[model samples]
Target: MNDNLAVLRGYFDAMKAGGPPAAMPFYAEDVVLEVPGAHPAAGIYRGHAGVGEFGATMARLTGGTFRLVPEDLLAGEEHVVTVATASANGVSWRRLILSTVRDGKLATVRFFEGDQALVDQVLSA
Candidate 1:
């Protein structure tokens, strides 16, 4: 695995081990997460605290049913693209996540979801 992939591996491992709190260590202090759509959980989150809040908000909106399962990882020097399946409220959608790595940590992430309307409907419901 490349360095970026390794970092993401650590991040995902942390998430699996202890949720967002554990994964915080793998993110840069000024990390940004951009979640798009017309749902309650859609927004731009900044820093570790913001990321935590985003996770919390999603969990609250989904009643803890929100889940992300990575199906593939394509890594370059500074970017890692994760092909993942995200599910919440019994609805699932594909997510193409582009994550930027800086200083051995995640600096930014933007998500492109397949079937945005379905995602919006499920999360908003």
Candidate 2:
């Protein structure tokens, strides 16, 4: 793993261990986070305020117990692709997260759930 990818992984690990605050420093001021069923962070989030809110929302939704267990991570010059399992609420789902890094911080993150049926079941329950 490159230095930037290592840092990004560390940030994700921090989020898994604690909450967003642990990973706050790894995000740029203008970070964009896209998740399913949410638009608060779809576009651009300027400064820590937006990043903080995005983290808070994630923590709330996952009951602050979300973890990303990376199966594979491929790092390019400007992007990193992570395949991991996100587990919470007594359920585990596989997801692919594509992240773009700018100046050693995360600029944008897009998540793709590989199994829709499993995701649907988890969401519906």
Q: Pick the candidate with the highest lDDT.
A: 1
Please give, for residues 25-123, the per-residue lDDT of candidate 1 as tens digits: 898999999999999999999998899899899989999999999988889998999999999888889999999999999999999999999988998
TM-scores, all candidates, are 0.96, 0.74
- Tens digits of lDDT, candidate 2, 24-125: 888887777766532322344456787677666556666766566888878888998988988867888889988898988888878788776665555444
RMSD of each: 0.8, 3.3
Question: Candidate 2: lDDT of 68?
Answer: 66
Best candidate per TM-score, number? 1
Candidate 1, superposed: residue stretches over 4 Å from native: none
